[model samples]
Target: FWDILEQPPGSYPEIEKQYFGTHVSLTTDIAGDYLIKLTVSDGYSVVSDTVTVSFYYENVAPSVETISAVYAIQDQTVPLDGSGSYDPNGDVMTYQWFFVSKPKGSNAVIDDPLAEVTSFYVDVPGIYAVSLAVSDGELEGKPYNPFYVKAFSLLGAHTKLLVNEDIEPQLLPYKERFVVDKTLTDDEVAKEYVLGRYTIEAVGKDVTISNISATDHLNLIKPYFRGWSENEIVVVKKGESLTFELVSPPTNGKLTDLSFSFAWSLNGVGDFSMQERFSAGYDFTSR
Candidate 1:
Protein backbone atom coordinates (compact mmCIF):
# COMPACT_ATOMS: atom_id res chain seq x y z
CA PHE A 1 0.00 0.00 0.00
CA TRP A 2 1.12 3.57 -0.61
CA ASP A 3 0.02 7.13 0.13
CA ILE A 4 0.83 10.46 -1.52
CA LEU A 5 2.21 12.44 1.44
CA GLU A 6 2.95 15.53 -0.71
CA GLN A 7 2.90 16.58 -4.34
CA PRO A 8 3.18 19.64 -6.55
CA PRO A 9 0.45 22.22 -6.03
CA GLY A 10 -1.59 21.21 -9.06
CA SER A 11 -4.16 18.63 -10.15
CA TYR A 12 -2.70 15.40 -11.53
CA PRO A 13 -3.80 11.89 -12.44
CA GLU A 14 -5.15 9.74 -9.63
CA ILE A 15 -2.66 7.37 -8.09
CA GLU A 16 -3.33 3.67 -8.79
CA LYS A 17 -3.15 1.60 -5.62
CA GLN A 18 -3.64 -2.12 -4.75
CA TYR A 19 -4.80 -2.50 -1.22
CA PHE A 20 -4.06 -6.25 -0.92
CA GLY A 21 -0.56 -5.92 -2.41
CA THR A 22 2.68 -4.66 -0.82
CA HIS A 23 3.40 -1.96 -3.49
CA VAL A 24 1.52 0.76 -5.30
CA SER A 25 2.11 2.71 -8.60
CA LEU A 26 1.58 6.41 -9.27
CA THR A 27 1.44 8.12 -12.65
CA THR A 28 1.35 11.88 -12.96
CA ASP A 29 0.28 13.80 -16.05
CA ILE A 30 2.01 16.97 -14.94
CA ALA A 31 5.77 17.30 -14.52
CA GLY A 32 7.04 18.25 -11.06
CA ASP A 33 8.39 16.89 -7.83
CA TYR A 34 6.29 14.13 -6.23
CA LEU A 35 6.39 12.74 -2.69
CA ILE A 36 5.19 9.20 -2.03
CA LYS A 37 5.02 7.14 1.17
CA LEU A 38 4.91 3.33 1.05
CA THR A 39 3.65 1.09 3.92
CA VAL A 40 4.18 -2.68 3.89
CA SER A 41 2.83 -5.33 6.37
CA ASP A 42 3.61 -9.09 6.75
CA GLY A 43 0.73 -9.88 9.06
CA TYR A 44 2.97 -9.10 12.08
CA SER A 45 4.27 -5.55 11.84
CA VAL A 46 4.15 -2.57 9.46
CA VAL A 47 6.93 -0.24 8.16
CA SER A 48 6.81 2.96 6.17
CA ASP A 49 9.25 4.80 3.84
CA THR A 50 9.12 7.96 1.75
CA VAL A 51 10.60 8.70 -1.66
CA THR A 52 10.80 11.78 -3.92
CA VAL A 53 10.27 11.40 -7.68
CA SER A 54 11.25 14.07 -10.19
CA PHE A 55 10.18 14.47 -13.87
CA TYR A 56 11.68 16.95 -16.30
CA TYR A 57 10.98 17.68 -19.99
CA GLU A 58 13.49 19.34 -22.29
CA ASN A 59 13.57 19.38 -26.17
CA VAL A 60 16.44 20.26 -28.50
CA ALA A 61 16.10 21.58 -32.03
CA PRO A 62 17.02 19.35 -34.93
CA SER A 63 19.67 19.91 -37.64
CA VAL A 64 19.16 19.56 -41.39
CA GLU A 65 21.34 19.12 -44.52
CA THR A 66 19.72 19.99 -47.81
CA ILE A 67 20.83 19.86 -51.42
CA SER A 68 22.87 22.85 -52.56
CA ALA A 69 21.82 22.92 -56.22
CA VAL A 70 19.80 20.97 -58.75
CA TYR A 71 19.75 21.15 -62.54
CA ALA A 72 16.64 20.07 -64.41
CA ILE A 73 14.92 20.42 -67.73
CA GLN A 74 12.12 22.90 -68.09
CA ASP A 75 8.48 21.68 -67.83
CA GLN A 76 9.67 18.78 -65.68
CA THR A 77 9.31 17.82 -62.05
CA VAL A 78 12.29 18.63 -59.83
CA PRO A 79 12.87 16.53 -56.71
CA LEU A 80 13.92 18.04 -53.38
CA ASP A 81 15.49 15.88 -50.69
CA GLY A 82 15.72 16.74 -46.97
CA SER A 83 15.99 13.23 -45.50
CA GLY A 84 19.29 14.20 -43.87
CA SER A 85 17.58 15.99 -41.02
CA TYR A 86 17.81 14.48 -37.55
CA ASP A 87 16.89 15.37 -33.98
CA PRO A 88 19.59 15.40 -31.34
CA ASN A 89 17.22 13.76 -28.86
CA GLY A 90 16.31 10.96 -31.31
CA ASP A 91 12.75 12.17 -31.74
CA VAL A 92 10.63 11.50 -34.82
CA MET A 93 10.71 14.49 -37.14
CA THR A 94 8.17 16.13 -39.40
CA TYR A 95 9.12 18.00 -42.58
CA GLN A 96 7.84 21.28 -43.95
CA TRP A 97 9.11 22.51 -47.32
CA PHE A 98 8.36 25.77 -49.06
CA PHE A 99 9.58 27.95 -51.86
CA VAL A 100 11.53 31.09 -51.05
CA SER A 101 11.83 32.37 -54.65
CA LYS A 102 10.81 31.41 -58.15
CA PRO A 103 10.61 32.78 -61.65
CA LYS A 104 8.35 35.75 -62.25
CA GLY A 105 4.74 34.90 -63.11
CA SER A 106 5.32 31.23 -62.23
CA ASN A 107 2.66 29.25 -60.40
CA ALA A 108 4.67 26.18 -59.39
CA VAL A 109 3.82 24.38 -56.18
CA ILE A 110 5.23 21.51 -54.16
CA ASP A 111 3.61 18.11 -54.54
CA ASP A 112 3.69 17.56 -50.77
CA PRO A 113 4.82 20.30 -48.44
CA LEU A 114 5.12 17.98 -45.43
CA ALA A 115 7.10 15.25 -47.14
CA GLU A 116 10.79 14.70 -46.46
CA VAL A 117 11.40 13.98 -50.16
CA THR A 118 9.15 16.13 -52.27
CA SER A 119 9.05 17.53 -55.80
CA PHE A 120 7.81 20.55 -57.68
CA TYR A 121 7.25 21.28 -61.33
CA VAL A 122 9.38 23.87 -63.12
CA ASP A 123 7.02 26.00 -65.16
CA VAL A 124 9.63 28.44 -66.41
CA PRO A 125 13.28 28.46 -67.37
CA GLY A 126 14.95 30.19 -64.44
CA ILE A 127 16.23 29.67 -60.92
CA TYR A 128 13.95 28.46 -58.13
CA ALA A 129 14.89 28.84 -54.46
CA VAL A 130 13.41 26.34 -51.99
CA SER A 131 13.70 26.03 -48.24
CA LEU A 132 13.05 23.21 -45.78
CA ALA A 133 12.27 23.21 -42.07
CA VAL A 134 12.11 20.15 -39.82
CA SER A 135 10.43 19.89 -36.44
CA ASP A 136 10.63 17.35 -33.64
CA GLY A 137 7.09 18.23 -32.41
CA GLU A 138 8.67 20.74 -30.00
CA LEU A 139 11.37 22.69 -31.85
CA GLU A 140 11.92 23.52 -35.52
CA GLY A 141 15.21 23.86 -37.41
CA LYS A 142 15.40 25.84 -40.64
CA PRO A 143 18.21 25.58 -43.14
CA TYR A 144 20.87 28.26 -43.10
CA ASN A 145 21.01 28.43 -46.90
CA PRO A 146 18.15 27.92 -49.32
CA PHE A 147 18.28 25.19 -51.95
CA TYR A 148 18.59 26.28 -55.57
CA VAL A 149 17.11 24.62 -58.68
CA LYS A 150 17.99 25.80 -62.17
CA ALA A 151 15.71 24.88 -65.06
CA PHE A 152 16.80 25.16 -68.69
CA SER A 153 15.28 24.41 -72.09
CA LEU A 154 16.57 21.96 -74.67
CA LEU A 155 16.75 23.18 -78.30
CA GLY A 156 17.20 20.77 -81.20
CA ALA A 157 15.71 19.60 -84.49
CA HIS A 158 14.47 16.11 -85.38
CA THR A 159 13.34 14.66 -88.71
CA LYS A 160 11.95 11.17 -89.43
CA LEU A 161 11.73 9.66 -92.92
CA LEU A 162 10.57 6.34 -94.37
CA VAL A 163 12.89 4.46 -96.71
CA ASN A 164 10.64 4.21 -99.86
CA GLU A 165 7.81 6.61 -98.85
CA ASP A 166 9.61 9.69 -97.45
CA ILE A 167 11.98 10.06 -100.39
CA GLU A 168 13.56 8.16 -103.29
CA PRO A 169 14.95 5.00 -101.63
CA GLN A 170 18.35 5.00 -103.31
CA LEU A 171 21.20 4.29 -100.82
CA LEU A 172 19.48 6.11 -97.89
CA PRO A 173 21.46 9.36 -97.79
CA TYR A 174 21.38 12.06 -95.07
CA LYS A 175 23.19 15.36 -94.54
CA GLU A 176 23.80 17.48 -91.38
CA ARG A 177 25.23 20.97 -90.84
CA PHE A 178 26.44 22.76 -87.69
CA VAL A 179 27.52 26.32 -86.73
CA VAL A 180 29.74 27.15 -83.75
CA ASP A 181 28.74 30.21 -81.70
CA LYS A 182 31.55 30.18 -79.14
CA THR A 183 35.28 29.97 -79.80
CA LEU A 184 36.97 26.77 -78.57
CA THR A 185 40.59 25.60 -78.41
CA ASP A 186 41.84 22.78 -80.66
CA ASP A 187 42.12 20.44 -77.63
CA GLU A 188 38.54 21.16 -76.55
CA VAL A 189 37.25 20.53 -80.08
CA ALA A 190 39.17 17.25 -80.27
CA LYS A 191 38.07 15.96 -76.85
CA GLU A 192 34.33 16.18 -77.65
CA TYR A 193 32.24 15.01 -80.58
CA VAL A 194 30.31 18.02 -81.87
CA LEU A 195 28.13 15.91 -84.19
CA GLY A 196 26.87 12.30 -84.62
CA ARG A 197 25.05 10.25 -87.30
CA TYR A 198 23.86 6.65 -87.48
CA THR A 199 22.60 4.24 -90.19
CA ILE A 200 20.91 1.08 -88.87
CA GLU A 201 20.43 -1.84 -91.29
CA ALA A 202 18.27 -4.86 -90.50
CA VAL A 203 19.93 -8.20 -89.91
CA GLY A 204 20.78 -10.18 -93.11
CA LYS A 205 20.05 -7.01 -95.09
CA ASP A 206 22.58 -5.95 -97.74
CA VAL A 207 23.28 -2.24 -98.47
CA THR A 208 25.60 -0.94 -101.20
CA ILE A 209 26.99 2.54 -101.96
CA SER A 210 29.51 3.90 -104.50
CA ASN A 211 33.00 5.05 -103.45
CA ILE A 212 33.47 2.80 -100.40
CA SER A 213 36.63 4.75 -99.38
CA ALA A 214 35.45 8.31 -99.95
CA THR A 215 37.17 10.68 -97.51
CA ASP A 216 35.73 14.04 -96.38
CA HIS A 217 36.40 16.74 -93.77
CA LEU A 218 34.61 14.53 -91.18
CA ASN A 219 37.22 11.80 -91.71
CA LEU A 220 40.08 14.29 -91.48
CA ILE A 221 39.06 16.39 -88.45
CA LYS A 222 37.17 13.41 -87.02
CA PRO A 223 34.68 15.41 -84.93
CA TYR A 224 32.95 13.26 -82.25
CA PHE A 225 30.16 10.92 -83.52
CA ARG A 226 27.19 9.18 -81.77
CA GLY A 227 24.11 7.73 -83.44
CA TRP A 228 20.71 6.24 -82.55
CA SER A 229 17.69 5.15 -84.56
CA GLU A 230 14.11 6.11 -83.82
CA ASN A 231 12.18 4.16 -81.23
CA GLU A 232 9.97 2.49 -83.84
CA ILE A 233 11.26 -0.54 -85.67
CA VAL A 234 12.05 -0.08 -89.37
CA VAL A 235 11.97 -2.81 -92.00
CA VAL A 236 13.73 -2.33 -95.32
CA LYS A 237 14.00 -4.62 -98.36
CA LYS A 238 17.34 -5.82 -99.77
CA GLY A 239 19.44 -3.16 -101.57
CA GLU A 240 17.82 -0.48 -99.35
CA SER A 241 19.79 1.74 -96.92
CA LEU A 242 19.01 3.99 -93.91
CA THR A 243 20.77 7.25 -93.15
CA PHE A 244 20.75 9.77 -90.27
CA GLU A 245 22.34 13.18 -89.77
CA LEU A 246 23.04 14.93 -86.43
CA VAL A 247 24.73 18.31 -86.22
CA SER A 248 25.92 20.56 -83.38
CA PRO A 249 28.36 23.49 -83.01
CA PRO A 250 32.00 22.67 -82.31
CA THR A 251 33.77 26.05 -82.29
CA ASN A 252 33.48 29.63 -83.61
CA GLY A 253 35.92 28.86 -86.41
CA LYS A 254 34.88 28.52 -90.08
CA LEU A 255 32.13 26.04 -90.95
CA THR A 256 33.32 22.39 -91.18
CA ASP A 257 31.93 19.55 -93.33
CA LEU A 258 31.59 15.88 -92.18
CA SER A 259 30.64 12.95 -94.43
CA PHE A 260 30.98 9.16 -94.54
CA SER A 261 30.56 6.57 -97.34
CA PHE A 262 30.82 2.82 -96.76
CA ALA A 263 29.94 -0.17 -98.99
CA TRP A 264 28.98 -2.54 -96.10
CA SER A 265 26.19 -2.07 -93.57
CA LEU A 266 27.29 -0.88 -90.09
CA ASN A 267 25.64 -2.54 -87.10
CA GLY A 268 27.13 -0.27 -84.42
CA VAL A 269 28.89 3.02 -83.59
CA GLY A 270 32.51 4.04 -83.77
CA ASP A 271 34.77 6.69 -82.20
CA PHE A 272 37.57 8.00 -84.37
CA SER A 273 40.62 10.17 -83.56
CA MET A 274 43.80 11.25 -85.31
CA GLN A 275 45.67 8.18 -84.01
CA GLU A 276 43.16 5.33 -83.35
CA ARG A 277 39.59 4.28 -84.19
CA PHE A 278 37.35 2.60 -81.58
CA SER A 279 34.07 1.05 -82.78
CA ALA A 280 31.39 -1.16 -81.15
CA GLY A 281 28.80 -3.11 -83.09
CA TYR A 282 25.35 -4.05 -81.72
CA ASP A 283 23.25 -6.80 -83.28
CA PHE A 284 19.70 -5.46 -83.35
CA THR A 285 18.31 -8.99 -83.80
CA SER A 286 19.31 -9.85 -80.20
CA ARG A 287 17.37 -6.92 -78.88
Candidate 2:
Protein backbone atom coordinates (compact mmCIF):
# COMPACT_ATOMS: atom_id res chain seq x y z
CA PHE A 1 0.00 0.00 0.00
CA TRP A 2 1.13 3.65 -0.64
CA ASP A 3 1.95 5.98 2.29
CA ILE A 4 -0.10 9.18 2.91
CA LEU A 5 1.85 12.40 2.23
CA GLU A 6 1.24 15.71 4.09
CA GLN A 7 2.84 19.19 4.00
CA PRO A 8 3.74 20.87 7.42
CA PRO A 9 3.88 17.58 9.18
CA GLY A 10 4.80 19.70 12.29
CA SER A 11 1.89 22.23 11.68
CA TYR A 12 4.08 25.40 12.33
CA PRO A 13 6.06 27.89 10.14
CA GLU A 14 9.49 27.32 11.83
CA ILE A 15 8.98 24.09 13.80
CA GLU A 16 11.99 21.77 14.37
CA LYS A 17 10.17 18.93 12.58
CA GLN A 18 9.56 18.77 8.82
CA TYR A 19 7.09 21.58 7.68
CA PHE A 20 6.46 19.91 4.25
CA GLY A 21 6.38 16.54 2.49
CA THR A 22 9.49 14.30 2.94
CA HIS A 23 12.23 14.45 0.25
CA VAL A 24 11.58 11.78 -2.44
CA SER A 25 14.35 10.23 -4.64
CA LEU A 26 13.54 8.33 -7.84
CA THR A 27 16.25 5.98 -9.23
CA THR A 28 14.72 4.51 -12.39
CA ASP A 29 12.74 2.13 -10.13
CA ILE A 30 9.49 4.04 -10.80
CA ALA A 31 7.35 2.44 -13.52
CA GLY A 32 5.15 4.08 -16.17
CA ASP A 33 1.64 5.66 -15.67
CA TYR A 34 1.85 6.15 -11.88
CA LEU A 35 -0.69 8.62 -10.41
CA ILE A 36 0.79 11.08 -7.83
CA LYS A 37 -0.77 13.98 -5.85
CA LEU A 38 0.82 17.03 -4.03
CA THR A 39 -0.78 19.18 -1.25
CA VAL A 40 0.20 22.35 0.66
CA SER A 41 -1.42 23.34 4.05
CA ASP A 42 -0.81 26.06 6.67
CA GLY A 43 -2.42 23.99 9.43
CA TYR A 44 -5.88 25.04 8.05
CA SER A 45 -6.62 24.26 4.29
CA VAL A 46 -4.82 22.51 1.37
CA VAL A 47 -4.06 23.34 -2.32
CA SER A 48 -2.40 21.32 -5.18
CA ASP A 49 -1.16 21.42 -8.83
CA THR A 50 1.15 19.64 -11.31
CA VAL A 51 4.18 20.77 -13.36
CA THR A 52 6.43 19.47 -16.16
CA VAL A 53 10.20 20.15 -16.78
CA SER A 54 12.40 19.72 -19.85
CA PHE A 55 15.83 20.83 -21.16
CA TYR A 56 17.80 20.94 -24.40
CA TYR A 57 20.57 22.74 -26.28
CA GLU A 58 20.17 25.67 -28.68
CA ASN A 59 22.00 26.46 -31.98
CA VAL A 60 24.67 29.19 -32.13
CA ALA A 61 24.05 32.48 -33.97
CA PRO A 62 25.57 33.44 -37.35
CA SER A 63 28.42 35.97 -37.54
CA VAL A 64 30.02 38.60 -39.75
CA GLU A 65 32.42 37.35 -42.46
CA THR A 66 34.31 40.33 -43.89
CA ILE A 67 34.18 44.08 -44.52
CA SER A 68 36.48 45.80 -46.96
CA ALA A 69 36.98 48.78 -49.24
CA VAL A 70 36.45 47.40 -52.70
CA TYR A 71 37.44 50.57 -54.52
CA ALA A 72 39.13 53.91 -53.61
CA ILE A 73 40.60 57.01 -55.32
CA GLN A 74 41.58 60.63 -54.76
CA ASP A 75 39.62 62.42 -57.50
CA GLN A 76 37.30 59.60 -58.54
CA THR A 77 34.62 57.33 -57.04
CA VAL A 78 35.19 54.64 -54.37
CA PRO A 79 33.36 51.53 -53.21
CA LEU A 80 33.21 49.35 -50.06
CA ASP A 81 32.23 45.70 -49.77
CA GLY A 82 30.88 43.46 -46.99
CA SER A 83 29.97 39.80 -46.39
CA GLY A 84 28.97 37.49 -43.49
CA SER A 85 27.53 34.13 -42.26
CA TYR A 86 23.88 33.58 -41.26
CA ASP A 87 22.03 30.81 -39.40
CA PRO A 88 20.40 28.16 -41.63
CA ASN A 89 17.39 27.74 -39.30
CA GLY A 90 15.21 30.09 -41.42
CA ASP A 91 15.89 32.86 -38.93
CA VAL A 92 15.67 36.59 -39.83
CA MET A 93 18.83 37.72 -41.59
CA THR A 94 20.25 41.26 -41.24
CA TYR A 95 23.44 43.04 -42.41
CA GLN A 96 24.94 46.23 -40.98
CA TRP A 97 28.14 48.19 -41.64
CA PHE A 98 29.90 50.89 -39.62
CA PHE A 99 32.85 53.25 -39.27
CA VAL A 100 34.12 53.41 -35.69
CA SER A 101 36.32 56.25 -34.53
CA LYS A 102 37.77 55.29 -31.13
CA PRO A 103 37.92 52.37 -28.66
CA LYS A 104 38.71 49.65 -31.16
CA GLY A 105 36.05 47.01 -31.92
CA SER A 106 33.10 49.23 -31.10
CA ASN A 107 29.65 48.17 -32.40
CA ALA A 108 28.36 51.72 -32.50
CA VAL A 109 28.41 52.10 -36.28
CA ILE A 110 27.43 55.07 -38.36
CA ASP A 111 23.85 54.50 -39.57
CA ASP A 112 23.63 55.14 -43.29
CA PRO A 113 21.74 54.14 -46.40
CA LEU A 114 24.79 52.16 -47.44
CA ALA A 115 25.08 50.36 -44.10
CA GLU A 116 23.47 47.26 -45.57
CA VAL A 117 25.06 47.75 -48.97
CA THR A 118 27.85 45.38 -49.96
CA SER A 119 29.87 48.18 -51.59
CA PHE A 120 30.01 51.99 -51.31
CA TYR A 121 32.27 55.05 -51.69
CA VAL A 122 34.90 56.76 -49.51
CA ASP A 123 34.19 59.91 -51.62
CA VAL A 124 36.30 62.17 -49.42
CA PRO A 125 39.87 61.69 -48.11
CA GLY A 126 41.23 60.43 -44.77
CA ILE A 127 41.94 57.30 -42.77
CA TYR A 128 39.00 55.01 -42.00
CA ALA A 129 37.83 51.54 -41.01
CA VAL A 130 34.87 49.39 -42.12
CA SER A 131 32.98 46.88 -40.00
CA LEU A 132 30.38 44.33 -41.03
CA ALA A 133 27.66 42.63 -38.94
CA VAL A 134 25.35 39.79 -39.95
CA SER A 135 22.76 38.53 -37.52
CA ASP A 136 20.52 35.45 -37.43
CA GLY A 137 17.87 37.05 -35.14
CA GLU A 138 19.06 35.05 -32.13
CA LEU A 139 22.31 34.80 -30.19
CA GLU A 140 24.81 37.20 -31.83
CA GLY A 141 28.07 35.83 -33.21
CA LYS A 142 31.52 36.50 -31.76
CA PRO A 143 33.90 39.14 -33.15
CA TYR A 144 32.62 41.14 -36.15
CA ASN A 145 34.74 41.31 -39.30
CA PRO A 146 36.61 44.60 -39.88
CA PHE A 147 38.60 45.98 -42.83
CA TYR A 148 41.13 48.79 -43.25
CA VAL A 149 40.92 51.58 -45.82
CA LYS A 150 43.90 53.42 -47.32
CA ALA A 151 43.76 56.67 -49.29
CA PHE A 152 46.04 58.23 -51.91
CA SER A 153 47.21 61.84 -51.75
CA LEU A 154 46.27 64.54 -54.22
CA LEU A 155 49.09 66.04 -56.38
CA GLY A 156 48.54 68.82 -58.89
CA ALA A 157 47.07 72.30 -58.42
CA HIS A 158 45.50 74.72 -60.91
CA THR A 159 46.05 78.47 -60.61
CA LYS A 160 44.58 81.29 -62.73
CA LEU A 161 46.98 84.29 -62.96
CA LEU A 162 50.77 84.87 -63.20
CA VAL A 163 52.90 88.09 -63.23
CA ASN A 164 55.68 88.67 -65.77
CA GLU A 165 57.14 92.09 -66.44
CA ASP A 166 60.24 94.31 -65.92
CA ILE A 167 61.21 97.95 -65.50
CA GLU A 168 64.36 99.73 -66.86
CA PRO A 169 65.67 103.28 -66.20
CA GLN A 170 66.59 105.48 -69.20
CA LEU A 171 68.01 109.04 -68.74
CA LEU A 172 67.30 111.58 -71.48
CA PRO A 173 69.48 114.64 -72.33
CA TYR A 174 68.33 118.26 -72.81
CA LYS A 175 66.69 119.09 -76.19
CA GLU A 176 67.59 115.62 -77.50
CA ARG A 177 65.58 112.30 -77.33
CA PHE A 178 67.35 109.06 -76.67
CA VAL A 179 66.15 105.43 -76.33
CA VAL A 180 67.51 103.18 -73.59
CA ASP A 181 67.50 99.45 -74.13
CA LYS A 182 66.27 97.29 -71.22
CA THR A 183 66.76 93.59 -71.10
CA LEU A 184 64.32 91.20 -69.35
CA THR A 185 64.78 87.59 -68.48
CA ASP A 186 62.34 84.67 -67.96
CA ASP A 187 62.44 85.23 -64.21
CA GLU A 188 61.69 88.91 -64.72
CA VAL A 189 58.97 88.14 -67.30
CA ALA A 190 57.30 85.57 -64.97
CA LYS A 191 57.09 87.92 -61.98
CA GLU A 192 53.68 89.23 -60.89
CA TYR A 193 55.28 92.46 -59.64
CA VAL A 194 57.64 94.70 -61.65
CA LEU A 195 59.35 98.00 -60.98
CA GLY A 196 59.87 100.12 -64.12
CA ARG A 197 62.13 103.23 -64.07
CA TYR A 198 62.45 106.04 -66.66
CA THR A 199 64.39 109.35 -66.39
CA ILE A 200 63.18 112.57 -68.14
CA GLU A 201 65.33 115.74 -68.42
CA ALA A 202 63.86 119.20 -69.13
CA VAL A 203 65.18 120.54 -72.51
CA GLY A 204 64.07 124.23 -72.24
CA LYS A 205 64.31 125.83 -68.80
CA ASP A 206 62.34 123.21 -66.93
CA VAL A 207 59.26 123.86 -69.08
CA THR A 208 55.85 123.89 -67.43
CA ILE A 209 54.23 120.88 -69.00
CA SER A 210 50.86 119.07 -68.99
CA ASN A 211 50.47 115.65 -70.54
CA ILE A 212 54.10 115.33 -71.59
CA SER A 213 55.59 111.83 -71.07
CA ALA A 214 56.22 108.38 -72.62
CA THR A 215 54.10 105.27 -72.15
CA ASP A 216 54.57 101.49 -72.55
CA HIS A 217 51.24 99.81 -73.19
CA LEU A 218 51.03 96.18 -72.13
CA ASN A 219 48.42 93.55 -73.09
CA LEU A 220 48.27 90.64 -70.71
CA ILE A 221 46.68 87.31 -71.54
CA LYS A 222 44.72 85.52 -68.85
CA PRO A 223 46.07 88.11 -66.45
CA TYR A 224 44.77 88.46 -62.90
CA PHE A 225 46.12 90.07 -59.73
CA ARG A 226 45.20 90.25 -56.03
CA GLY A 227 41.41 89.79 -55.97
CA TRP A 228 41.10 90.75 -59.63
CA SER A 229 40.76 87.79 -62.02
CA GLU A 230 40.91 89.18 -65.54
CA ASN A 231 42.99 90.89 -68.21
CA GLU A 232 45.74 93.15 -66.80
CA ILE A 233 46.98 96.52 -67.99
CA VAL A 234 50.53 97.83 -67.33
CA VAL A 235 50.36 101.60 -67.70
CA VAL A 236 53.82 103.27 -67.90
CA LYS A 237 52.85 106.93 -67.65
CA LYS A 238 49.83 109.15 -68.37
CA GLY A 239 51.17 112.73 -67.83
CA GLU A 240 54.20 115.06 -67.78
CA SER A 241 57.74 114.63 -66.37
CA LEU A 242 60.52 117.05 -65.25
CA THR A 243 63.83 115.30 -64.55
CA PHE A 244 61.64 112.67 -62.99
CA GLU A 245 61.68 108.88 -62.88
CA LEU A 246 58.60 106.60 -63.24
CA VAL A 247 58.29 103.19 -61.57
CA SER A 248 55.56 100.68 -62.41
CA PRO A 249 55.03 96.99 -61.69
CA PRO A 250 52.98 94.33 -63.47
CA THR A 251 50.32 92.40 -61.62
CA ASN A 252 49.66 89.55 -64.10
CA GLY A 253 51.52 86.68 -65.80
CA LYS A 254 51.12 88.31 -69.20
CA LEU A 255 53.91 90.81 -68.56
CA THR A 256 56.80 88.48 -69.44
CA ASP A 257 59.54 90.74 -70.87
CA LEU A 258 59.64 88.43 -73.91
CA SER A 259 56.00 89.11 -74.80
CA PHE A 260 55.86 92.81 -73.83
CA SER A 261 57.81 96.12 -74.35
CA PHE A 262 57.33 99.89 -74.87
CA ALA A 263 57.41 102.78 -77.38
CA TRP A 264 57.75 106.35 -76.22
CA SER A 265 57.33 110.04 -77.36
CA LEU A 266 58.30 113.11 -75.30
CA ASN A 267 56.39 116.39 -75.94
CA GLY A 268 55.13 114.81 -79.18
CA VAL A 269 58.52 114.75 -80.99
CA GLY A 270 61.04 111.91 -81.48
CA ASP A 271 59.97 108.29 -81.00
CA PHE A 272 61.69 105.31 -79.28
CA SER A 273 60.20 101.86 -79.77
CA MET A 274 61.37 98.48 -78.43
CA GLN A 275 64.26 97.32 -80.59
CA GLU A 276 62.98 93.75 -80.57
CA ARG A 277 60.13 91.77 -79.01
CA PHE A 278 61.08 89.98 -75.78
CA SER A 279 61.71 86.26 -76.10
CA ALA A 280 60.52 83.68 -73.65
CA GLY A 281 63.67 81.64 -74.45
CA TYR A 282 65.97 84.33 -73.01
CA ASP A 283 68.19 83.38 -70.02
CA PHE A 284 67.05 84.65 -66.63
CA THR A 285 70.23 83.98 -64.61
CA SER A 286 71.85 87.35 -65.34
CA ARG A 287 68.89 89.34 -64.03
Please, what is the whole-model Cα lDDT of each candidate in the order they appear?
Answer: 0.55, 0.34
Per candidate, the number of residue pairs that clash is 1, 17
Best by TM-score: 1
- Model 1 over residues 1-287: C-alpha lDDT tens digits? 77777777884746665465455567876668888777888889999898998876578899987865645556668778898888987899999999999988789999999999988988877778999999999899999999887665433111122332343111112322333333433344433343334543332332322222212353233332233232222333354446544333333354445443332222222321111111221111100
- Candidate 1 Cα outliers beyond 4 Å, as residue runs: 1-57, 155-287
For candidate 2, give the lDDT of residue 35.
Answer: 33
Q: What TM-score should be assigned to candidate 2? A: 0.28
Tens digit per residue, CA lDDT, model 2, 1-287:
12223322332122122334355422222222233344566669877654332222355677555643322233333334444455645467676665644233323234452354444344444545666565666665534435655433333211111122222221111122222223343444433332322233222222222223223334222221232112322222333232222222443323332222222232232232122111111111112
Error of 2 at 264 (Å): 63
**Runs off by more than 4 Å, candidate 2:** 1-57, 67-71, 88-90, 102-116, 142-145, 156-287
- Which 10-residue window of candidate 1 scores lowest in summed lDDT? 278-287
* TM agreement with the true structure for every prediction: 0.37, 0.28
Colliding pairs, model 1: 193-224
lDDT: worst 10-residue window of model 2 = 276-285
lDDT score of residue 212 within candidate 1: 25
Model 2: lDDT of residue 56: 25
